[model samples]
Target: MPGAVEESNRRLLRARDAMDRRFAEPLDVPTLARIAHVSEAHFIRTFRAAFGETPHRYLQRRRVERAMFLLRCTERSVTEICMDVGFSSLGTFSRVFRDVVGEPPSAHRRRGPLPPVPTCFAMAWARPATDRAVPEKRPERLRP
Candidate 1:
C-alpha cells in the first residue's frame, strides 16, 4: 500500500513538474492527464488530494509567482508581463494577479525591486498565500 501511494505521488509530481516547466504554454487537463498516465478525473482528484489545490489553480499560482518576480525586478509594462506569463487578456491577468497576490500588478510593481536578500529567502517571503481557502459570498438578508 505504501508503495502504491508513493507511485501515485511520483506520477502527480511528474505532471506538476511539466506544468512548472511549460507554464508559459497553453496547457490543459488532457495533456496533464497524459503525463500522469491517469484519467482526467482521477488526475484532478488526486492532484487536489496531494497538493490541496486543483491543477489549474496550481498553474495560475505558478504564473502569478513568475509575474510577481518580473513586476518587482523589471520595468516591463503590466500587459507585457501578463502576456509573458501566459495570460492572454490584460483584464484576466489583473484579476488573477490581484486574487493571488492581494494587489493589482501595478500596485505590486510600485513596491520596487526585491531587496538584496538571498533568492530563496526573497521567494519564500513573496510567495502567495494559497493555503487559505477563499470564503464563499453569502446572500444578504432583506430587512422587514
Candidate 2:
C-alpha cells in the first residue's frame, strides 16, 4: 500500500512538472490526469493529497511567481506581463495576483525587486501561501 501510494505521488509529480515547464500553456485537469494516468476526479483528489493544492491553484501560483520576477526585473507593461504569464485577461490576472500576493500587480511592481540574494532564497521567500483565501475583487490599478 505504501508502494502504491508512492507510485501515485510520482505520477502526480510528473503532471506537476509538466505544469512547471509549460506554465504559460493552457493546461486543464483532463490533460494533467492523462499525464498521471488517472481519471480526472482521481487526479484532482490525488494531486491535492500529494501537493497540498489543487492543480489549477498550483498553475496559477506558478504563473504568478513568474510574473513577480518579470514585474520586478523588467520594464514591461502590466498587460504584457499578464499575457506573458499566461493570463488571458488583465482583470483576471490582476484579481488572481491580488489573491495570491495580497496586492495588485502594480503595487507589487512598485515595491521593486527583492534585494540581491540567492535565487533559491528569493523564490522561497517570495512564494505565496497557498492556503490563504482569495481576496475579494477590487478595482485594479494597472499603472506603473
Candidate 3:
C-alpha cells in the first residue's frame, strides 16, 4: 500500500482507539474528524471504508459490547446498565440490544452462565454477532 493510504489508516485507527476507550462519552463526527484531521464527510466515508461500519454504528456496537459484559457479570438492573453504558433512553438501549444480539437484554442475560475460561475468550465468545439487515422499527413504550 502507498504511504499516504497507510498513514490515513493509522490516523483512522487512532480515532477508533479513542472511540473504543471513550465509548461512554458523546463522540460526534466533528470530534472524530478533528481527531483524524479530516473533513467530517471524509472522515465518515473513510472510516466506513476502512472499518466496514460507520463511526456512529461502531460506537454503538462498542457500547453494546460493554453492556453485554455488564449484563452477564454484574447484578445491575437493565436500566442501570443501559444508562451506565451511555444510552440515555432505555427504549433505545433495548431496541439496539435486541437488534444486535438477536434477543432482548433480559433474555440474553438469562441464557447461561459465563463459561469457565479466560475473560478475553469469554468476552469474544459472548459478543453479539453483527446482523447487516436494517433494524426493525418498533413502537416505543414509556418506561419509568
Best by TM-score: 1
lDDT of 1 by residue, 21-132 (tens): 9999999899999999999999999999999998988998999999999999998999899999998999888888888889999999999999999989999999999973
lDDT of 3: 0.87
In candidate 2, what are the lDDT values of residues 1-144, reduced to their tens digit?
469878988899899999999999988889999999999989988887888888888899999999998998899999999999898999999999998999999999998877799988988998888887654334489998
Considering summed lDDT, which 10 consecutive residues are worst modelled in model 3? 130-139
lDDT values of the candidates?
Answer: 0.91, 0.89, 0.87
- Cα deviation of 46, candidate 2, in Å: 0.7
**Model 1 ranges with Cα > 4 A deviation:** 132-144
lDDT of 3 by residue, 7-119 (tens): 99999999999999999888888999999999998999999899988888888888999998888888999999999888899999998888888789999889666878999
Most accurate candidate by lDDT: 1
TM-score of each: 0.89, 0.88, 0.88
Superior candidate under TM-score, 1 versus 3: 1
Give the TM-score ranking, best first. 1, 2, 3
Clashes of each: 0, 0, 0
What is the TM-score (0 to 1) of candidate 3?
0.88
Candidate scoring better on lDDT of 1 and 2: 1
